[model samples]
Target: MEWDWNFVRQIMPALVEGVKITILASVLGSILAAIVGLAIALARRSPHRLVSRSVGWFAEFIRGTPLLVQLYFIFYVLPDIGILLPPLVAGVIGLGLHYGTYTAEVYRAGIDNVPRGQWEAAKACNLSARQTWTHVIIPQAIPPMIPALANYFISMFKETPLLSAITVLELMNQAKIVANTYYRYLEPITLVGAFFLAISLIAVVLLRWLEQRYGRMEP
Candidate 1:
């Protein structure tokens, strides 16, 4: 097939719509993952051995499993047990959960890097546990962790294509549909690649800026 400028233009709108869905899923998933990761990190640090070990094992299991399998289970398998979710919801959950395990490690590392003296100082001041974490620990830990978290956000964006397996109309899924409908693979697939490359390059530049701004402040 000759390069079809007309077809490319025709498909652009749908592809752009798909791009919006892709970005939405990534942003929402990243937010959920950040929250879940912090919870896991904190739970793993609990004074109770059972709490810590169980959270540790859960994190390990999630990290060890394939994301695709997790997606399938969330979207397909759970319905058998009466938990039905929309495709987008299932995909978001799968992405958040799979990446949350990795982010938990990043959180753990950041939390660990906080100076022991900070903890001692909080104790000396008789600060409550909540006040210490709020005022001292998290503020110190989060900045250095920003660049790493941004990298994972970018990774989650790339992985949005996998949501197609569960029927979410992300970029790759839209591209496949466009190609199938028009019987022209070249333009749609190439455009999908171009879109991903453009976004990824932009994210890389932002990641670099974040690293420069926060990495040097590491304690």
Candidate 2:
């Protein structure tokens, strides 16, 4: 079929709306992932063996499963257990939890990269464990981790399309709706790809800026 300019114009509004939802979901989900992942990372590094092992197993479990399966379990299986969430909530939870596992690894890497001497110095100063973490280790570790955390935000942005499977009506879902209704997949799908590419490109530039800004602070 020939390129359809009229169809593109007609669907532009819906696509724009869908893009907004996609952006919101990605942003909120990333926030959740960052917080949850940090907690998991700290748990994994705890002196207590049980806390560390439990967190390690949970992270491994999440990483091993397909995101689609996790989405299904959250959206479908939960209702059977008397817990029902809206599609949008389920989508956010699924995306955030899945990416949290990935970010935990990133956080662990950053925390590990903090030199042993720093930890020793904190001890030598007679700092409490919490004081050591807050003042010395985290201040050093978190700067390097910013780039990785920002990268996860971009990754989650692309993965928002998976929300369509659970009917979240995000960008890809909107595109698919337009294609189904109008019987023109090329324009809508092409627009979807272009939209995602544009957003991802912008995210990459922002992440690089963050990396450079933070990288300067490290000794």
Candidate 3:
């Protein structure tokens, strides 16, 4: 079968636009995950066993569930309960919440790696609990967490295709639409694969650079 360069060239603009949505969703979702995950991680580390246990159980529940089911529940079920959201809103929330659970675990690992003496030293300096966490522990922990966070962003990018199931017009969804309309999968699908590979390669290079930068700052 001849690969139709003309079709690919013509649809490049559409493909690029769709890729923009893919990037936006992933970036925004990662930001949400970072913020929410930090909170959840801290909650799970609280001195109060009830707070810790509840947060831990919620994180575990989210991690255990299928992302598709979560998406369906948020996008479909919530509307029936009168908490309607736009498709994009639902998609972002679902993706953010799902990955936030994983990011919370990453935060836990990084925070746990901080030396025990660091906490003692902060308290010796008369730092309050909030001050210790904000000024000491998180500052030390966040650098190591950046690489893992970047990797999660890449994972979220790949998962953006799932948003299409909820009717979000992300890259894969747009490609599928084009294919259905034109009765041609070759150009649209190939272009979509190439687009994803290119972006993923860029993300890998960026992550490596960040890891190097953070590694130098850590010690």
| Candidate 1, residue 152: how far the Cα is off, in Å | 1.1
Give the clash count for model 1: 0
Question: Stretches of candidate 3 above 4 Å error?
Answer: 216-219
**Which stretches of model 2 miss by more than 4 angstroms?**
215-219
Per-prediction TM-score, please? 0.98, 0.94, 0.95
Write one digit per residue (lDDT tens) for candidate 2, span 93-138: 9999999999988888888988899999999999999999899988
- Candidate 1, residue 22: CA error in Å? 0.4
lDDT of each: 0.94, 0.92, 0.89
Give per-residue CA lDDT, model 3, range 46-113, as digits (tens): 99999999988998999999998999999899988899988788888998998999999889989998
Which stretch of 10 consecutive residues in model 2 shows the poorest summed lDDT? 210-219
* Global local distance difference test of model 1: 0.94
Residue range 1-219, candidate 1, lDDT tens digits: 788899899999999999999999999999999999999999998999999999999999999998999999999999999999999999999999989999999999999999999999999999999999889999999999999999999999999999999999999999999999989999999999999999999999999999999977965
Candidate 3 residue 12 C-alpha distance from true site, Å:
1.9
Best by lDDT: 1
